[model samples]
Target chain A: MVVDHFEARLVKLARKGDQGAFAELVDLYKDKIFHLAYRMLSNRHEAEDIVQETFLRVYKSFHRYDDKQKFSTWIYRIATNLCIDRLRKRKPSYYLDAEMNDQEGMDGYTLIPGDERTPESEYLLSETQEMIHQAIEGLPAKYKSVIILRYLQDLSLQEIGDVLDMPVTTVKTRVHRGREFLRKKLENKVF
Target chain B: MDCKQASSLMHDYLDEDLTHGQAVELKSHLKDCSACNERFKELEQTEMVLFAAIKPRSITASDELVDRIMSQIPNQRKQQAWIGWIRKHPALTAAAMFLFVMLFSAISLWESDDQLVVKTADLDQVIINGNTVTVPSGSTIAGNLTVENGKAEIYGDVQGNLTVIDGSYYQASTAHIAGEIKSIDQALDWIWYRITDMFTEVAYK
Candidate 1:
């Protein structure tokens, strides 16, 4: 189905102060934005909070949203900007809430249950997941964002460029460098 | 392609962003160059692991998140509604305002209740009734004639332009005008005519 038609209608109604339309918008994008924030910040609670804040800001500035661009691009830009801001504010030592939970004796792997597997296999998978998360966390915010949006969110290079306000070539370069950085970090570790 | 060039284009190849010729060239180089090939393999593996490692779990939007956002929006939406309304109907709003000003000016002009007559007349042959000035039928005015708050009835010959302020001009069939006739209805035009007239009188004096 043509979702853009429906989304555009919702945006039109939302612009005119339709709460129900805006709520529909929230329902549509909440998970996408929440996932993006979670990947960028690696904290479920904070990601959820950021998603709420992102929508709030979107609602407040709905009048400023240019109709020339797709609504998805605009919302992604807002969410990515918020994530980048939160990342920058935590620079020098950006710690994920998962790491904090680890310190508090509740590791991320145990908290999130998954399909049935051998204990050893599950442990290995969990550790590898944590390690990958740390490698992504170790990247600078710019490269880290490109990697998250590219791989985790499965956005195209052009879409990532739009969200990051960078050119396509620049986004490609970041993706390459970000992958190389993660590769070097995972050199000795088993996948 | 040489190893150095192939290395630089490795990401483009993996992303499938290369031209067919470039991809073919890079592939040939990779077949011969194990070192570059290993590096490409490692990069590809890292990307695969990166994608795999991100657990796909739905993070449901919290009930409070919607509630909190909705709560904050009511006040903001109220403020934005006014701004949005203006943006949406700028032409309509401007037209309405223009119509209101026009109606208001018409009503005010009607309420003032002042009737005026202006004419060109010789000093010896004009009749003045408060705001009305009339030129007698047999009189001839030799110079420019200007009247304020008055109407002009030209049964006689006017040698120059007959200008009237806030009044009308009526010319009899026997009237002969040597120059133009003009009526000033608006306040600004009347004021401007008076100012120029003052300057003309000052210069002549």
Candidate 2:
């Protein structure tokens, strides 16, 4: 509901060439786009560029939006396609196991709640997060795209179908396969 | 349904796309089947953990984003398909006419960076842009400049002589003048001085 309300107001102001309203749209979706881009590219700077570029494009093309489409779905399509394009051009990983770039976007990604927790628990959580990221990254692009959209971006199946231009039945099947992949990869795993 | 059929349809079942009759049939099958029951339990646990592990995490953009994007926005002359209406529904000439009018206005209001901006550093032979120009302290423009809509800030020094077609020039205390300086604004305000000193200043200038 909050997202819907924001979308409505942003659509009105953004249609009239309002930069401030466009900036607000950036603030709203920047993190979500950044997460997807970062996961896909495994690079912080590229992800940051993707976020800004995504917003700039939305600003440039906002006037054409039909308002019938959900704003989240529209933005997800943009980010997902951009990520796919980046993936298509990237060289295959030389190594099966790549160290995650924790140093790249240092402190840019905040862990939600770690206060008063012991170091061991926090370390486990961070390692777990990294392991999950690595496992998801290793998936084939099609499967990875859907999983990240459904799990990471929190889009529903229908919304993901809209974003990826897939039938909802196909989306569900892909999600199940993706989840099974994660299950195998993460099974009995530890740092 | 046996375990295989039930497991295969688990995703559909969980999605609740199953019709009432099919759902009833499946529920009865699960009730009587042991191996299928275990599979369901396994699926339920796996679903719980996977869903728990995949909560959406928020990531923040770096603060330099605005700076980087703004820097690119300037000097960006690439024509974009605005709204795509012009290309998409070309049968509508009226829309193109409206776009042409807006484009004309934006262009007339447009200020070329080279015309208005001048760098303050000989090595600062930077272009000044806008209606007026002023060199800022401790900065250099390394190339020719243009300006359209605003003024310039020159605090440091200019490598090349400055040229501006219009607009006031504000030279700060920290400003250094290396290149030849000219201001259209200064002429009007300093007309008396300029006129009186024209003869003496003509040869040097």
Candidate 3:
């Protein structure tokens, strides 16, 4: 609660053209937004780009932000929307079933980025973790966002709804369906 | 409990969204059903693995990224400050805009209004020829004289204030006036005169 009050104060100060306050906000959410974008896009450079663009947009449109809503939710919504936009641009015909067919022909080694497979990094990400990441990368954008927000960001169902501008029931259904999809994808493999 | 009810409860349990009673029921069912128990364990393992894989990486944005974002912000802040000033002083901004528009239109109207007009209560006492109004020698006018967009020559006058708008007035050496002569050439002065004239007309009416 004290942190929430401090964050609200920072938002108020930033809205009044305080650059230092805005920098503090950026410092606070930069890694969180980057992690979200990285999970969604599976690309480090693009994730960084998303982080930059999200903060730029947030700074540009501070007046539109409603003080009643959670600032974190609003920032997450911006980051999520930017990540989705980049995903859609990467694959214009991005359908739920389309990527599944494409994944079958591709090996897991090829699915992982070539430059990211350092020996230490490979040791850090176990086979199961790598498989889970690949499965998540292949999920449809709709399910992908909810799953990441729920499991990764640890947002509540209500916070996810607010961020996605959807009802809590819809968020619940998506999270369930997303986990079920992951369960099916990882079925018959090592738990 | 049936397998279907148990599966739904299992998902709810994983989310930690289930009521305590529902969780207890699901727990009891898992104990009784081997297949449901196995399925719940796999789901729980998947949840755990997912949490491990997606847990916040120690990924921090580089100082260069912060510098890039901060460098871009000063430009936007400058523009926002200007817009914010207008937003903060809406009434002053609106009044300034209104005054600007009114001044602009008044100037345009004055420039476009070039038709010659002459008014006098005693028209018979003056000679009107072309765009010039002349009070001939030894002629006495009883009332005020106003001329617009035309020259006014007063040789002899015994009248109220003589007003010339957007035109020059010539008073001969023999000219005599009972009141002050006023010449309005600027658009702003003409507008002020028109306003006062309207108020006086309204009062008289």
Candidate 4:
């Protein structure tokens, strides 16, 4: 799961105008970054846009990168910073596109069709997920950045600290504190 | 490690960053403490669920960025020095030049104090005369009031304290002082006696 020297060489090549290698690198991280952006932003479209923007930023800044430091940390830092900025501007209650047709009923903010046969548990879980998203939304940017890097991006505590430019203790504290807060928010609904 | 330390360290322990001895100690503690062990399980599960939920969403790159970078690149090959110039944008170059001049002037002026004349007082402001740093009887201090190595006279409402370091001053009868008067004069030296002499002689007479 870790990017190795082989990938590092490929990144170096990509930075030096190897379009094919650049494309390959994009293909490699797209899904993971897409999901990261999606979970962080909660809007699929915005997440996708962030992923795209993140890649562009990566390309532009690649020349300035220090390979001694892990490239993954560098890119993940960029993505996490972007996500935090978006989250700071985002409001607590988001408007999802829900269908209001006769066949499909509204499940909270999500639409459910009569013939769609989506499991009841799925809808409930979605609502709970939405609530969790809002709860995370309420957290300060510092906590959210650490939580996202730890949980969503699957970065290690050390990696999270590297990205946040904080110590490992600070990252752990933020992650623990953020999770405890979410635990309180998701207590009745998800638990 | 006891249960308390073991549980507190479980997070670091899970990172596999602990030394063998520490990890083993925590493991031994966990075996004895069922409550801490149970909490550890819940904590691990929560970590798992959160980790599993983190999936990277695919993001599409902007075509404009690629095109823009690609376009500038061809020009770079035509002239190698051009890349350096391009990298150092006009604004940055100007800023660098300005900084260079500023630093040069700063260093030059730093050795000479004539150009660094600091105006300490205005006609309306307080003036320091020998032993006394006198405040204009009916003036206001917009900022901090300081008396260094000498005493201060508070004829007006001082917002801060009046300090007499190694010396003292008495307020005039017309004074309306608001702040405290601090005297750090340990010994009643000749200076204090001389200052007292003027008032004492007047009082005796």
The most accurate candidate by TM-score is 3
Score residue A126 of candidate 3 by CA lDDT. 62
Ranking by DockQ: 3, 1, 2, 4
Residue A77's lDDT within candidate 1 is: 92
Q: In candidate 3 chain B, what residue range of length 10 has the lowest lDDT sum?
A: B54-63
Query: B68-125, model 3: which lDDT tens digit per residue?
Result: 8988999988988899899999999999999999989988988897988888888899
Q: iRMS value of model 2?
A: 4.3
TM-score of the second chain of model 3 compared to its true counterpart: 0.61
lDDT, candidate 4, B99-155, per-residue tens: 989767755643343221112223246766765666667776543454545666756
Shift of residue A125 alpha carbon in model 2, Å: 2.5
Instruction: Give the Å shift of residue A152 in candidate 4.
Output: 3.2
Report per-candidate DockQ: 0.41, 0.18, 0.52, 0.11
lDDT string for model 1 (B88-200, tens) is: 99999999899989768755754474655343445666677676566677788887787766666778777888887677778888787788777888866755776787998
What lDDT is obtained when candidate 2 is compared to the true structure?
Answer: 0.64
Stretches of candidate 1 above 4 Å error? A91-125, B58-61, B82-205
Give the better candidate number (1 or 2) by TM-score: 1
Candidate 4 C-alpha lDDT tens digits along A1-191: 34686788778898786877777677767666666665565544566568777787777667688988887788787887888788667654432322112211223323334433232233334454445556655566778777877777778888888987889888877877777676556555665
Full ranking by lDDT: 3, 1, 2, 4
lDDT of model 1, residue B154: 71
Off by over 4 Å in 3: A56-64, A85-126, A167-169, A187-189, B18-33, B62-99, B108-160, B163-175, B183-187, B194-205
Worst 10 residues of 1 chain B by lDDT: B113-122
Distance from true position, residue A75, model 1, in Å?
A: 0.4
Tell me the RMSD of model 4 versus the true structure.
23.6
